[model samples]
Target: MCGRFIDANLRGSDSELSHIKIDPFERRFNIKPTEDVLILAKQSLEPMIARWWLIPSWHKGGLKDFKLTTFNARIEDAREKPTFRAAWHHGRCLIPAGGYYEWTGERSQKQPHFISSAGNEETLWFAGLASRWQELLTCTILTRSANETVNDVHTRMPVILNAEERDAWLGGSDDLTMGAGALLRHHPVRPFGISDHGPDLIEPED
Candidate 1:
């Protein structure tokens, strides 16, 4: 599952880009779950903002109230899951980041690695879905079975969306399957580091 990530090179000032604003936090190398990160979604024709983790409206209580495992939704089962189906159809979103983290192996022997664009684009947007669980709002990143590139690192990767598909993903249309394969590009072993300002953290290379 995608529990951590990086969003270092955001172009908040770029008018062509969507809802992202200039974040005060310095580029992060280790972004954990429940932490507020930038998401690009739409409210009508205009882009809007949303937090990373998704909280279902049926949930009761605060941050301490729910389990932390809802951060990601499997692409194959998301449409059938109660927590994600509504958002999958009506509240689709885009999570903007430099890269994401994944892990491999048992607790003591787990490894970390990072994945990013081949060209090092300013930002990468993962397809996401969001919902408003009472007063609290939340989101979940979509994950697919690993491709050739990601197979070496982990068994799954987030559903990444390219610039052209960004508009459709955030448009909240019934066609949730559009651009599923075309928009995504994958990289298995790219440059990574332990520092906070460089690449995203995945399981350590074993």
Candidate 2:
């Protein structure tokens, strides 16, 4: 499951659909779970902005009752899971991100890595599903078994969508399985310099 992510830019503007832009944050070298991140979704046939974590409206008591982790949804079980089934069918969405964070290490010492497109692509949109839990809406990223490049870092990776599939994902298409399988990209991990929030942690670019 992907709990932490980084989106240095926050899109907010008058343009209805073209407002997607990154804001200047001190470069989130390390992003933790529950932190507000940016997501791109379609509303009334136009793109809109949403936060990363799906906070259902039913969770009125505050963040506790929503015991379910609304971060990652297993590709294999999402269609049948109560929390995700409806969204998979009618409430699809997209998460626009610069990169994501993964950890690999022993229980005591965990090391985090940033994963993004190889080139200087401005953003990467992830295949996602969302739902409106009462008045509050929530969302989750879909994850499949790791590909060869990501196997060493973790057993799973978020299902990333290509440019073509972005529309289908947010269009409420019924063929979710096929649509999701078509947009995945798995890149090998190279040595890249990444800094931690507290101390300076950098690695050689691979």
Candidate 3:
């Protein structure tokens, strides 16, 4: 599951949502769940800042009272899962990420790895779902079985969207995976604390 990732400006002026201003978007390293994130939902031209964790629209309790693991939802059964059912049909969104972090090995010796684009691409748009808990906007990334390279570290990875698939995805399309996995590349990185912030965190470790 994708638990951590990086966020930066939405690069490439020619992108589908490039017309929208993302200046308020912050550059974050080691971004975790329960934090604010940027997302572009259906029928919206402006980018929104949403919580990394999704709280279903049907939830009626206080934020602290609800407890469910919804940071990532599996595409295979999200539509059937109660937590993600509402979002699956009408809450489609696009999550902007530079890349994501994955851990391998045992708990005592977990190794961190950064997965990013293997091409000239500057941003990776993850397929996501958005929901509004009252006035609070929240989102979650979608996942599928891993591809060849990512399988070496984990069995599942975020369903990243290519430029061609972005518009269709936001339009409530189901065929989200369009060979986008092949564009990925990953490498080991130095361990870092949650408070650490900078571009160097993504740099390769010896």
Candidate 4:
């Protein structure tokens, strides 16, 4: 699961959602669940804030009901999962992220790896699902089986969306879902994950 990620854009100036003006955000190298984040929905290019964890509208419980993990919805099961089906079909969204973190090795020897776009882009847009609960907007990132490059580190990775695929994903058409599958493949730029942190965190480590 994508439990941690980096929100490198502290200034809204570098935002991909430039169509709509956004306020500056706190830069976070290690973002956790339930944090408020900015997102772009299919309904509009405007930027909106949403809690990272999704709470389905049908849920009867209060915030305490958030115990069920709804942060990462597996792409394969999203359509079938009751918790995600509604949002999957009607609440599709784009989540901006610098990169995400994953761990490798046995529990005692586990090491952290940072995954980002293969290109020099500052932010990676993720395919996401969002829903409204008690006037609050919440979302979850979608994940698929890992591509070859990141398969060694973990068997799963978030579905990273590219420019061309963005419109199709936000299009909300069933046929586009089929096309979106092709984009699910690993990025072409050789390296997938780096093992260290620092200014070069997004770069592949030797």
Candidate 5:
């Protein structure tokens, strides 16, 4: 599950996210669940801010009603799960991030691992689902079983989308359903240890 991530582009001039105004976003290194996040949803050319934890529109109670984790939805079960099914079909989105955080080791000895792309790609797009609870918009990242590069750390990872995949996702077409699964495979990731927020966080700890 993707519990935390780094969003370096929140303040930068990202052409893909240019539609978003500058004043609302702040540079963030340790983004957590239930916090406000930037997302590019279907059919919209502009970026929008939404809660990181998705709250389905059908939910009648307050935002605190459901205690179950809605921050990350398993791709395999999203279509069947009541909380995510509606959003999965009609509310797909792209979550931009510099990298994501995961952990490994026994419960008492777990070590934090920072996961990012292997090369110059500054921003990684994570496939996500979004919903509206009253006037508040919220979203959830999609997760898949981990691939070779990250399987040693965890059994699951976020479903990452490339430029082409992002186009299909934002296009709101039937092709999205077919192409979504293919993008679920992990890319070559650069994993390093990070104890806190800093430039050195991306570097391997020796």
Candidate 6:
């Protein structure tokens, strides 16, 4: 589950996300759930800002009313879960992230790690689900079993999509064959929890 991540320039790229230009997306090294996020939803040529948590369209209560952890939806059960089902079937979207954070070891001495693409691709597109509640737009990142690069620090990682998979995902294709392998890299970083968001936080610790 990606509870926190980094939202930065990521060296720029000409991939599918090159067209996504979100204003005031100022670099953030410590983005957390419930905060505003950048997402490219289906049927839209431009990206939009959305509450980083998924709020079901059927919800009529206040935002604080629903607290079932909708920020990160598990890919395995999202298709059936009430909070994400509708969005999963039709509101699929894309979220771009420079990298994400994961913790390992004992609760008190947990070590944080920053994980990003192993290749030259700087922008990593995350398969997400978007929803509309009242006058607000909300979204949630999808998570799948961790691959070789992330399993050591966590059991799950966000559903990462390469350039080629963008069309299929936004076109409402759940048959996303994530392929037999994943290309990713991880390195230890200083622990900052939800406090510091400085760029230096991503620097390798050791």
Per-residue lDDT of candidate 4, residues 1-206 (tens digit): 68777774635565556556566465656677898987888756557899999999998888885688988988888878899999988899988887787877677665667776666456778888999998999999988777766777678778777776677778874432432332221222123333323444444555
| True lDDT of residue 63, candidate 3 | 97
Q: Highest lDDT: which candidate?
A: 3
Model 1 per-residue lDDT tens digits across residues 97-120: 777666565776565566665543
Q: What is the TM-score of each candidate against the true structure?
A: 0.75, 0.71, 0.92, 0.81, 0.82, 0.92
lDDT of each: 0.65, 0.60, 0.83, 0.73, 0.74, 0.81
Question: Model 3: per-residue lDDT, tens digit, 11-38?
Answer: 5674555777676555888799999998
- Candidate 3 local lDDT, residue 157: 90
In candidate 2, which residue pairs clash?
9-22, 9-23, 10-23, 54-138, 54-139, 191-205, 191-206
Better of 2 and 5 by lDDT: 5
Which segments of model 6 are wrong by more than 4 Å?
A: 8-20, 43-45
> What local lDDT score does residue 67 receive in model 5, on the 0 to 100 scale?
81
User: How well is each residue in 50-169 modelled by candidate 6, as lDDT tens digits?
Assistant: 899999999988878986788998888888898999999878888888888898889899899988888767777888999999999999999888888778888888888766677777
TM-score, prediction 2: 0.71
lDDT of 2 at 92: 77
Ranking by lDDT: 3, 6, 5, 4, 1, 2
* Model 5 lDDT-worst window of ten: 179-188
> Candidate 5: deviation at residue 153, Å?
1.5
Error of 2 at 74 (Å): 1.1
Give per-residue CA lDDT, model 5, range 34-92, as digits (tens): 88988877666457889999988988877778787899998778877999988978888
- Model 5: which residue pairs collide? none
Looking at model 1, report the run of 10 residues with the lowest lDDT sum. 182-191
Clashes of each: 14, 7, 0, 0, 0, 0
